[model samples]
Target: MHNQQQRIIASAAQREAAQAARLKIRAGFDRSTAGLAAGMTQVNMISVAKDWAYDFLLYAQRNPQSCPILDVLEQQHYHSILAADADIRTDFPRYRVWQHGEMVDEITDATAIYTAHPELVTFLIGCSFSFETALQDAGIPIRHIEDQHNVPMYLSNIACRPAGRISGNMVVSMRPIAAERISEAVQITAKMPSVHGAPIHIGHPESLGITAIDRPDFGDASRIAADEIPVFWACGVTPQAAIMQSKIPFAISHAPGHMLITDIPDRAWMN
Candidate 1:
């Protein structure tokens, strides 16, 4: 009974935090969602035309580690089942609008694009942030959250399996885990397969074709402590990388580190 009450309280708190964060975002507070809405699930979003939706879906299936899809909103739908009454077009802190694989604009609100292209299909992919609270609860430190910076992400030479017209390399987010706690960190995240589970690589960045540890292709670089080793996880940004490399005629995605804060409790995704 005691544990049940605790869960009820945590669920309510997660809902409150998720709603508040969305409200702030809708009001034009543009920033990374890292460490925001603690204990709630967060997701990355990508919207492509209806005709291109199946290809993207196949790509996600072929690359589950990098693209664990949670919810998909069909053409003309801007609402997601994961978050009640949330507007996908404006809830994310920032969005990248793409044209022929080129990023044309970065905006706080994506309503204009959705309004203009109502036929677009939106996919909500799982984010690593959803499993962060678990790591924190396990007494593991998250360097980017502690430093109040966006998590560093890199484009790797590791190629993703091709699906239809969609094909590109994988993108990965890095976290510096203490050498002693690396096992614990991996175990904590491995249970949440829906949220890019487990470290895809650890220690050597070069193995993944990352040339620099301090400079990243996306988000902010984080400091690696003397006792820590860089741990890499498959990143949802992989789809955006595909959009760029595949030269998708049109697409939109949440900016790296800028994710959709959903009402779902983080515990819901835990194994």
Candidate 2:
């Protein structure tokens, strides 16, 4: 907990708002947030109209591994109770705006949309970054971060159970782990269930219907070394897939990897 607290203090002292805003502005031009804001709890954000809130929450509830709920904010609220003094709209580096299930725009802020429709309900879903710190602490390397690329994510054959109108194939993020360190990665991540928990699949992506290891469906491709096995974890991006499938009238999601760095300590999510 000491280590986690130190990270929170250090990051907060740097003014997360300025960092986030700068990152967002830069991402709008280049589009990547792979290794930013290291050590803090980064959360995936999704927002829908108040009318669809119940169904969306049920969807998250049914898919805990992919859509672990960290906080639920009602219409018109931007501050997160989970992350003290945090602004959900501007704290995130980037955002994707969807209209009728189609991606309409990618922006740095969501204030305009929220202002137009104040009844939007926002959900903060746990992100895998929380566990990545733990894995790094255990001497496990994150290849994407090493190469300064977005973490590779894939759409798997695994289908999430339908919750109302929201249902789709499970999406996963992959990290190349040395054969001998697979168990160590599992043990470290398993302790943080709120942050997507442990790896769902290790080695051989084809078993999960992923045809190419280097050609990922989302994010950047990561190299798999000869001695390394690809470890897959259910990803926060899963909801975006579900949202696309559901084709709801409107929705907002944090651009992949551009997460909300919260004030909540990483240990708070540890079970």
Candidate 3:
């Protein structure tokens, strides 16, 4: 089944209310928030030991395009100035736990883990949701949303500048845009720098070292229509790649497409 043609753009208040309600359920969902909280900022979550927080923060500073830091919550700090009274541990629908550079398990909630490891620091990174909303406003078609699939992501040949123990290849999200509107999409997304501004590469996927566009390293594969070309944007998931590559003793990150919806307005990130 196909999703509606008219994009669903909700007000900030409406999205926040709905997110809060969804999070209140005792059992968490395994759903993607790709088009949810339409006009609000959706940030990615990362938690590392207090000892490793400095390295991760430095890594984000080194790779702003892929790891834009929105808010840094100190040890056991749950409340965010960017998000009003939102619980980091339970807000996101899903979480990935990593130990020794390996994904140990996927869990619905990390509150218990956080309670146990009081020294873990949380970092909320910027996401592409804001730029995505802008593209929809400009009359560009988002194929993944129409087909109800998570945005396609892949690890690229490009390597991020290493910061201490954190370093890895950059990851990107792909969206198929009509060849004619490719430039228009670039201009629209460029306005939101904090949310991965503009396309890093357009057209051939092999140039970015992607062997098969149909087989993505993360998220669902998207169909590239005959008239459309794939547009790649640096993804927030790059940090997860970094975590896995660096093999941090322990770390936590939001599952791809399941972001932490913040109270900040989408417009706040406009360049």
What is the TM-score (0 to 1) of candidate 2?
A: 0.89
Query: Mind giving the per-residue lDDT tens digits that candidate 1 earns over 1-92?
Result: 11233232246767888899999989988889999988888899999999999999999999999999889999888888788779999999
Cα lDDT of model 2 by residue, 182-207, tens digit: 99899888888889999999887889
Candidate 3 displacement at residue 14 in angstroms: 3.3
Evaluation by lDDT, superior candidate among 1 and 3: 1
Query: In model 1, how large is the Cα lDDT of residue 151?
Result: 98
Against the true structure, candidate 1 has what lDDT? 0.91
Clashes of each: 0, 0, 1
Q: What alpha-carbon RMSD in Å does predicted model 2 have with respect to the real structure?
A: 3.4
Give the alpha-carbon lDDT of every model.
0.91, 0.82, 0.85
TM-scores for candidates 1 onward, in order: 0.96, 0.89, 0.92
For model 2, what is the alpha-carbon lDDT of residue 187? 89
Which candidate leads in TM-score?
1
Question: Which regions of candidate 2 fall more than 4 Å away from where they truly are?
Answer: 1-31
RMSD of each: 3.4, 3.4, 5.7
- Residue 182 error, candidate 1, Å: 0.5
